[model samples]
Target: MLLISIIKTALELLVKLLELSNEGLHRLLSDAGFTEQRAKCQQRLADWLQGVARVLTQDGRQMTGSYAEGWANSMVQVNGRTAADSDIDWTVLAPGQEFHLRGGCERKGSCKDATPLQVKEGHAQVAVGAGSQPAVTATACGVRPAQDTCHAIECCSSFFKNRIRKLLPYNFDKVHLVRATRPSSTNELRVSFSFQEKDIMRNLSTDQGQLFTLIKFIFKRHLPLTLDTPGLKTYHAKTLLFFMLEKNDTHPSIEAWQPHNLIALLKESLDMMLSFIDSSSSPNECMPHFFMPDAPLYFKNAGIGGDFDNTKARVRDRLCELRSDISGVVEQLRGLVRPLQSEKFYFHPFTLLPLTAPPAVTEIRKGMYSPEMYYKFADVYSVVHQCVSELQSESSDRDTLMRQLSILQQLQWCKCATLCMTAMAHLKFGESEEAERLAMELQRHHVVSGLKPQDIQADKYDEPAKLPEDSDWAWRFCLPCDSPPRFPFLPEFTQTLFTARLSQPLSSHLYVNFRCLSWSLQAELLRNRAPAYAFDHWIKELLGDPDLEELLTLAHYSDCRWHVRLSLQQMEMIEKERRVAMETQDEENIGWVRQKWWRVSNRSGSGSDSGAHRSSEDEEEDEERRLWARARLGLVAMETAAEQRDSWTHTKVSWMRLQ
Candidate 1:
């Protein structure tokens, strides 16, 4: 009895040791990021084992009484199957004796004797009668198919049997419960489920074990070392936060799940993204072929509009803050970099589609003058104009210039051009003074260059010149001068040229010939008379073409009609010259007279007697007397023809008939 008691005490101590080991293993595993519910699993298993052991001890001597005696009686029911009657018995069920009950088994001797049961292949018999009416046999039921199994034992037992199915000692073809042994020195517990390939695949498909595996891999193997790398800190933090948010829809789910050094890392990442956004050039600059107005709506829709005035106000405030920050950075950069003097710096304008006036302009106006800021605005206007010009040149399908002009007209630099064009448009409406004033202002700034009035007098000359009613002939005359006197000749010559060009077909050709002749005659005449006047007049006539009069008139309309008065004086001078040349009777003098007469006739077809008549008459009367008569007659005929053509032509013919 003492030896038996000692053995029992040793066994009890061994059981206690096992329980303590199980408890320590459970605690270690739980602390290792294992499921916390696993503690309840361990406690339940211990209770089950203890119940099995107590039942076995109580029924040890009653094996012959019923199928429930001894180990068979202590066999736990699993998944609705009695262990003794199950074909695939669990390892936890001990070998037991089979008992058969006869009919009316209230008599002790009526029941069959006990036989050692083959726990693997035996059946159980239950009493149903007093005599040996063949014992009511109950066939052993095969272990419930794994699919119908839900008990933790069944799951574990199936897992164990599958793992070592090919091994000899475990070749009973029955699932068995196996407990993992604790390592001798370690306090940590490792609980592993041996799942079949199909079970693993199913669990994976459902994402059941994925979260746990990821957590284990990250915390156990990846975290500390990954966090140690400074370069990866921000990236990993953002990734972790993104993943955490994705995993749980509820924000509270991640409230306790803090990544290592996450806050600092997130702040760094945000700063980096912001820096990238600010420093990167706008898409418009990078891709200029894209029309700014037609750029994606996302850029347009980025800010508030319409009734969201409050939101727009807040956005403007934020923009002001951002601008200030950027300005500080730019100043620092400028100080450090010291850009080349000729290098152009540009700022992109803030363009709002469906533009609303910005309120920040008021604040900006209060700052001290900055040349850089001034240039920035100027550059924006310039770039916009360049873009407008480019678009206009390339495409006729769109009115890009007009649209850009409309937008830019509000700006000061662009306003000049807009005002100039507006003035031109106003000119057609008879606001002549307004137009001229605006034009002058525009020209002063070099906004619009080289705009002057245009002469309307050419239109008046479209009809042919008409003779006065009392005139004997219709006469038009042009005096071609090489270099005429400034006071009298230059102005007359310019008027004749203008009139001839407007009324006569041979004006241009005659003007050239007369210029050469006039220069020779004037040089000779002034050789003994006013040389300075001659030189000055030569310059004036040479410089003043027909266009000069028209240009002056168009440009300065109120200027006097100097050209018309000069023409009358030139006619009188021609009469005087003819008379003086006649008395001289010099052929050279007559040649000058003939050339002048030709020019006059070519221009207006209204000059006096032809040079042929003057030469013939001078020869007939010893040259001098006949020349005088010819000169007098030429003068009279020139005046008559200048008056009217019909009577003059008839009178000349009648004189010829009389001769």
Candidate 2:
């Protein structure tokens, strides 16, 4: 009894130790910006591929592998210590049924239909028909299929790869593909079960998945220590994980897959792998593919690298060492996953534009004081305009909207103007509830708060206030201000290319003012909560003369965009009202309302005033009263234009822009 009691106490202590290690690992992953960087990379890649799909007219491209699975290690010290070198697995489904081929068995004996096997995840096995084939030649590729069919698949893979290569933009050389071939053929037929793998990874319980990531991360760091050759890849670890889960499914009562048993699970998985390594009596020496169980994953004749046994032996020893010191493993893993050094103001307005390359120093000089950079901003704005307009026609869930906006913001591709456009869209759709909620949230953003009339002017006189290094402002892919972004997430980079675009003082400052146009919509929403008179004060204080107008004029000078000039004109009119309000305090509210009516009427070409022809001068004298009637009509037209323009199909001016 005492011996059993002691063993229980020891197990409890081990469990406690693992729990602590897990906590440390979680914190390390979070701090390293692993998840955020992966997300940023994925989003940027998706955007690029979306454009590619449109151009190629393909069905779609799917992101797969560890990058998609969310446990991808972007920064690793092993395997040459390269940056942004993690392989992104993509499956580009071609358009049309051109590549689809019928499958046939290689064996010549009277072929019989194979009975469908039981599969997990509510999926049934596909019944193999005699003399018939699957769409992919590689599907159910257990035994060697027809060589002709395999050759067809290889041809299809090559065709798409070549087409993609031709379509790749300049400076995208960093993203290159290395074909995975079979042992028999130098160039093997490729089959992607990435979607299936992703689904399986997604279904893993939280702890189960984390444990797998922990093991893989550690394995990556130490695998190099074991040998100088390619022994077992990360995919091998994933296959073992899949097997462990399958084993756990069969014995559900054991609950060995839970968080507390992570250490046990790791040890068990390592032991199983070690058993396979030591099994000399067994003729088969390769691990089987998880999806196609009969298919060998590691081919002895493949000539990948090193002796398989020696490699596995080293791996087993290293893993056993990690198992003994789980806490030390966690600490060592932290060193492997280095958090990107935080650079001050790494994420500013310019970083968001998705330039093909960082702006040249000469271009930066021109953009800060000249109109040369307007075209780039215009291109970014055009895409963002299309994106927002597309969004307006369709309704998305709250989470979707938040995710889209967050991605846009993180990319620095969007300014305040874009969200304002979306909010106006919400209101137009009669989604007032969501619109108000969004507007209130925008009001709280640091960018909007920084655009306060006083703050805008103060930035010029005082040293520009340093952006707070708060969580909200954290940049996913930040480098030093002088360094050009090296990742595929941004444009291409040359070794000699060095510019301060990320820290451009005037452009970043001016971007805040441009985004501040959302204040008009925010104030409009605030009107429902406050009296009508309060609306003028909100607008006057936020968009009041001098500060906002000066910024607008600067923007107009730099971009020469028609919309910027129009905005400048509108601000001038508001400035006129501010002057009138100052001189005639008694009639300030009344004049403010009249000026507002004229501005709306001008854009819509109508007013509250009667349109009926005056019979005499007496009728003309009563035009002020008639203006009230015309103003209401004009407001309705403005709203109509707003609603229509929100549709991507329409090309009319946005009502919010006029404001």
Candidate 3:
């Protein structure tokens, strides 16, 4: 009776420990910005997809994978700090999207009652309203085109060749082809069941969701397994989880998964994975796909047959080892939960930059360090700006601005941008003191250096390199091409980075641009109170900036020292045009000319097209056009014959005269 009592007490203690471990794991995940970061990553992909679809005239393309599933593990560590490994998976539909197959589709038994998330065959599925954003929204893709009627691979190739490839060096530059399959001689294709997977994933409870994240986190941190792991991909782990949940659904009232069962659940999952390996007698026998039980999820690559076998053998041994010391493993995982510390430094995974140190504006000015994360940061900045604009316009309460500022504050790497936005916000609120304070803060934004500079050499005209390997985290430097044209959606720098065939990293365009913006804000604040000559110090400093000369040398910057020069030139031109119109007393002409120049100047200053995908040649043509436009606006003569021959020059000048 005493032995029995002790056994029960020990079992209860074990359960309590597991529950505490689970809570600790949850805290760690939250601290690493998993929840918010995942959302932003998803939003980024969705926004990119929307932009791509609009450009391609294929409004049916939908983003998928971990991003769409809402369980993206953005906290995957590299060199002991979090980094984004979210490779966007999107399905590009062929023509005749809403058609039928010869026979109706048959779904898995578990998904029998579930709403058909994707259109497959004879039966049509429409998107039903859902509570959340992005995932629940579905578009009809009636059936896979019959092999006799349409060659899907050929269509994909042609689409890439004719439409997609033309946008090289800009949009779709970072895309990687993760999978391709030759199902049959006739039907070599690329397929995605993300829509079906999305339906299953959305039903996961909060505890289940955390468990999923915890597993992925464990794989990334400890086991160091990734999507590229042969026979034991992250997809297989996710599928295993789905199978476990579905199996447990038979007795729904009795929760099969609880926080207290964290270690047990992990052990069970490993045991399950081991079972698949042990039970499989041949290459043909493998772990079943969650949506299609007959289809093999593991060992799908016939070419990597030997590699898969070896990987499985290794994984099986590892799984057994893990299960044997599951408690110890749980303890190690629990150790990841550090004591809650104030967020003094937020490491931004997306940029791979730390936000710990205070601003060194002088270092940026003197060193002229080109920001490695600048373009990437600008992309995220555009998204945040849109959100800020939406909230600013919609919400009247002071709390809304504070809440937004608070969120930005948590993202410490974006110190300058945060300070810039806050200053603007305060300026809008008529708080000059606060605005000035933020401007001062912006001038002192945090910066870190001394790491080996990113190799700036890239050929924009060259075909984009293949996606970086699973182990390669420094992908930003691997394919440094022109920024995608999602312009005027939010403000971005006009000057383009010289990315092609670079011998070395250039001076800091990003920091220079930030400095320009800071000075502009300061000048605006002082426009009323301070003397006009008070701006002389700032003007002199900007004029003497070493990076100023380099900007003019860059092909894209064109006859301007910096953004401030371009902005000043643009404003002066607008005033000149306005004054001329006023002299004639032509109110209609005054409004029309003013509006036209403003749009033209903003387009020129933003340095990206109106979200259209363009080839290298097209990009060059646009660059020349911008140069001419800038010259025309500045009331200066064309310097070269090539500049004189710009096709846009005639049209723009003619339009200005007509207005």
Query: For model 3, how does the per-residue alpha-carbon lDDT over 115-197 read when each residue is reduced to its tens digit?
Result: 42232211123333211111211111000000001112111111121222222212222111112332221211223344445
Give the 10-residue window scoring lowest on summed lDDT in candidate 3. Answer: 140-149
Give candidate 2's TM-score: 0.39
Name the best candidate (by TM-score). 3
After superposing candidate 3, which stretches have Cα over 4 Å from the reference? 1-20, 30-58, 76-82, 97-179, 182-187, 218-221, 224-230, 250-254, 283-285, 300-302, 305-309, 327-516, 519-659
Q: Write the per-residue lDDT of candidate 1 for residues 93-147, one digit (tens) a residue.
A: 2234212222112223423343311111011122221221112222221111111
C-alpha lDDT values of all predictions: 0.26, 0.39, 0.39
Give the winner by TM-score: 1 or 3: 3
Clash count, candidate 3: 1
Reference-based TM-score of each model: 0.13, 0.39, 0.41
Per-model RMSD to reference? 50.4, 24.2, 23.0
Candidate 2 global CA lDDT score: 0.39
- Clash counts for all predictions: 16, 15, 1
Query: Candidate 1 has what TM-score?
Result: 0.13
TM-score of 3: 0.41
